[model samples]
Target: MRTAKRPLQSQASEAQKQAALRYILDAWEEALHDGIEPEMLANAALFAALADLIDLYGEDAVAKMTTGLSRRIHHGEFTLRRTAQ
Candidate 1:
């Protein structure tokens, strides 16, 4: 029974994550339509994300997690556009 429950729980967790992302993206789009500059929005988004993560997981843990972000960014993990090299 425990093993069976794990799949259901994982699916629910994934669904929740998707829903949360949609909500955040919708709010971000609305903010942009309301005249918020993209750079300002990006800064505020990073601050909010880091602050909430630190609050939930502590400063040291969040700092460690963020240390990999530079490598991820360089690898284009967050890139929306790709062109032929």
Candidate 2:
């Protein structure tokens, strides 16, 4: 009997995603070690980092900061990306 294949998003169990994310993140870390400032990181990594930070700092502080940030965004107090920079 032929078995079905899973989509890449859910394929290779956990190892594939972990390996790709680890490779990308290690490049960022190596850049920092080499005194280079990365202009951007993947959104997935950012979300993970935020979750890790919240775990480290607890909910209250991170929540307060995000709430304030949202308030600033609502008030037009922060810069946003443009269509063309």
Please give the RMSD of candidate 2 to the true structure.
Answer: 15.4
Instruction: Please give, for residues 13-84, the per-residue lDDT of candidate 2 as tens digits.
Output: 588877976787688788778876555444556688667656655556555557677678777664434456
| TM-score for each candidate, following the candidate numbering | 0.75, 0.34
The positional error of residue 28 in candidate 1, measured at the CA in angstroms, is 0.9
Query: Which pairs of residues have clashing backbones in candidate 1?
Result: none
Q: For residues 1-85, could you state the per-residue lDDT of candidate 1 as single tens digits?
A: 0112112123347789889878988998999999999899899999998777666566666666788999999999888569889
Once model 2 is optimally superposed onto the true structure by TM-score, how far is the C-alpha of residue 40 displaced, in angstroms? 14
RMSD of 1: 7.9
lDDT (CA) for every model shown?
0.74, 0.60
On a 0 to 100 scale, what is the lDDT of residue 22 in model 2?
A: 77
Instruction: Tell me which residue pairs clash in candidate 2.
Output: none
